[model samples]
Target: MHEVFTSAMLAASVAAAPAQLSSIDELAGTWTLVAADLIKTDGSVVRDYGNAPKGLLVIDSGGRYSLQIFKAERVHFASADKGAGTDAEFRSAVLGSSTHCGQMRLDGGQLHFHIEGASFPNWEGTVQKRNFEFTGEQLRYLVPARSDGTVPVSVWRRLAGQAARP
Candidate 1:
């Protein structure tokens, strides 16, 4: 009877304990892109950045971060001059990459990016909130739904030996 009571008490105490909290400091490091996908409302997945995307994300302990993602299969501009690209080439170039830098903070299990500037000029000076989770070395985040109702999701793996310096 005593053993039974002790076991019951232990289970009750464990049930009353809160889940372990996650800290923003755990995100401070250099991460490489694993995948960039878009999820449709009907449950179909689209690889918007091609089958193998390329990207980098760097987060500092000081709350600053820079993120860049690019399509690995972008078409090369035929012209040697950077400013001499055709309209289609320019559009392809713009559509193939995204980059932004800003201050980031975690609140209520969400990450808020206060954009100082971005390749997409409309995002400059705006705050974007993302729902994110960490699994082992990978960090995954869901982008808010767009007007078309597709949600973008990005997965990044923390680079080994790239911990943030004090």
Candidate 2:
């Protein structure tokens, strides 16, 4: 019963999405993160990654991909050695960045991630779906709503001269 309902919901979402790229090859290339925001139920926006978030996304023609996002102002560890960081520094580091990678599938306007690994261990070995749209060189996607009802949205811009795979 649960599976049936889930399938129905998935079908509905796909049907409701706007026109999508004709082929996944259209999404192949490198993208730079432009904005990361959390929209509250009351319609206020919060910058989850500060004013200047840094991120890179690379997707290959074979459907393999890697992604990393960082807070521009994340505090550097006081110690030179990465293995030697204070608890505070470690916590700050972990909380300020997001990284994950794996195979991807684009179905309609949905971007599905078969997460093989992530900075947040809970996401490893999980499959997540996001709704996305493209505008010129930019792509925007909405993350599933969090338990607190805030939705995270990410925007990315394709780099110059990155050709799409046929």
Candidate 3:
């Protein structure tokens, strides 16, 4: 489900906006997940996504954003019903997917995500701060280390349109 920021909400946020991101106007478009990696504190890497990860991140002019990421290859549950998945299926679904939507603020080198909702209940109503960098068409960020002592870094590339371009 996509939640949109109405005109009033957008006006209110812009009224007190201290962190202006005019420099990152190039990021006002749809971006597709290009790469994702989790680095453990032990200096090991977990690559459960094989070679491809599927996801989308959309950023609008109002600072509202939505992100969804998932493993490209997930096993199907035995039951076709959405709520009747087996334990293993449920586990896989939870472990291999993430979804969050809310407003975001970019201040200098720091990025803040004011999460309105998330697939991980613990993250709902929380603010996540991260260091971010944008190079060419790719936007990258280093998330704060997780409770498991792993840091997940994600890269997103702008999705080009079919028409016009060199």
Candidate 4:
């Protein structure tokens, strides 16, 4: 009787343990930037995505993320090895283009990102975090200001059937 009771108790405990956090595998795929809203310090709204500026975000199953931003009449520089110019000149001439590689993980319902790259030199040692809320077809991510500044919000729509394979 004692042996049976112990076995049952252990089984119940195992079953009661909370499920592991969902991996980035669930979010892996190419995601197009649909729209963005920026809240200014004075509480004004800015709809700047529909202009010349555009953005793209790609998340891989291996917890890597890449982001690209493009704008009209922007002269961006490439690495000298790519035949653009010297490394120093390339870095100085790069105006608004940015490429960042980062690790991402999902905890509960929040998505966390750790950024790394020379593209955004200021963000080299920083970890940018965001909270994600999902609806039927849209996922809204809210990013709070690191300091006491205004916050930025992004809304992404999933491409049909592009979720990572199980």
Candidate 5:
């Protein structure tokens, strides 16, 4: 009876071990732009937004993603410079363009994000995704460049349990 109990306990522990491991489900949700620091190849940090740049990242269980980034200062410029142009026009010209697309899973932990009509031509290529880590309420993922040349790395954080609109 003692041996049987010990075996059952061991089996239960083993079964629960996989659950402890992190999975992509942890990343499924909407993420607000907490902070984005673009690191240049020369190790220079460019703080374009000065603390808060409006941005959002949405990850779905069906393997889809959409991202938007904007600058608060641009709204003022757009209104002044665009000549009655809508806020969208000002945002596009100033903060750059937003990216939308579906992601394909390369493996259990890696994903290939194909940007749909990315504003930046260089980013239009396939993005290799990896290195996912979660701390507290934040989930981060790394996007490496497909080419050997310099590429920007993106770090994303969860958006307080809000569902991704797109």
Candidate 6:
């Protein structure tokens, strides 16, 4: 179940929460996507990547962000050109990837992802809300539901210095 932050809860949290988290700067850094699991209603977890998923969530000082998450065993396009991949290859690539670019906002630890565009066209121009948690160098968020009615909980780790493009 999701935690709802009431006024009293917000007040209590603000007292102990660091000031940086009150602003976007708290999220301004390179964060490696550690997990994205589809939580089935049955309580079983379905993961996109068989092993550790490959992903990157980068936030600039301006609060603008870009994210790319992919499965580990993706096959390279035999055609070598992005647009020229075979039909099966295209299906595998598309189904195994999630990408988006936009801006981020936080309200009492809740994160709002303002999508300018996304690989999944349905999400383009949409604003999705998620509950966020910060623990040490980790940031976690829960996306209510994906198209399949499965919840996706994303975990990210704060990376020191510039990380390779994901």
Write one digit per residue (lDDT tens) for candidate 5, span 9-108. Answer: 3223323323222444555787776544443455454443444567787777666777776654453443464578786775556555345555634455
Best-fitting candidate, scored by lDDT: 2
lDDT of 2 by residue, 49-96 (tens): 777888999888766889998988888999899999999889879988
lDDT of 5: 0.51
Residue 113 in model 2: shift from native, Å?
A: 0.7
lDDT (Cα atoms) of all candidates against the true structure = 0.75, 0.77, 0.69, 0.57, 0.51, 0.72
Superior candidate under lDDT, 1 versus 6 = 1
Estimate the TM-score for candidate 1. 0.83
Rank order (by lDDT, best first): 2, 1, 6, 3, 4, 5
Error of 4 at 91 (Å): 11
lDDT of 6 by residue, 35-134 (tens): 7666665546667454667899989877899999998778788886898889889888888889999998876556788999899998999998876667
Query: What total of clashing residue pairs does each candidate reach?
Result: 0, 0, 0, 0, 2, 0
Cα displacement (angstroms), candidate 6, residue 129, comes to: 0.4
Which residue ranges in model 4 land beyond 4 Å of their true spot?
1-21, 48-52, 73-95, 146-148, 161-166
TM-score of 6: 0.79
Ranking of candidates on TM-score, top first: 2, 1, 6, 3, 4, 5
* Clashes, model 3: 0
Write down the RMSD of candidate 2 (Cα, Å): 8.2
Error of 1 at 41 (Å): 1.9
lDDT score of model 6? 0.72
Better of 2 and 4 by TM-score: 2
As for TM-score, the candidate ahead, 1 or 3, is 1
Candidate 5 lDDT for residue 14:
28
Over 4 Å off, model 2? 1-17, 164-166
Question: Could you tell me every candidate's TM-score relative to the true structure?
Answer: 0.83, 0.85, 0.78, 0.62, 0.57, 0.79
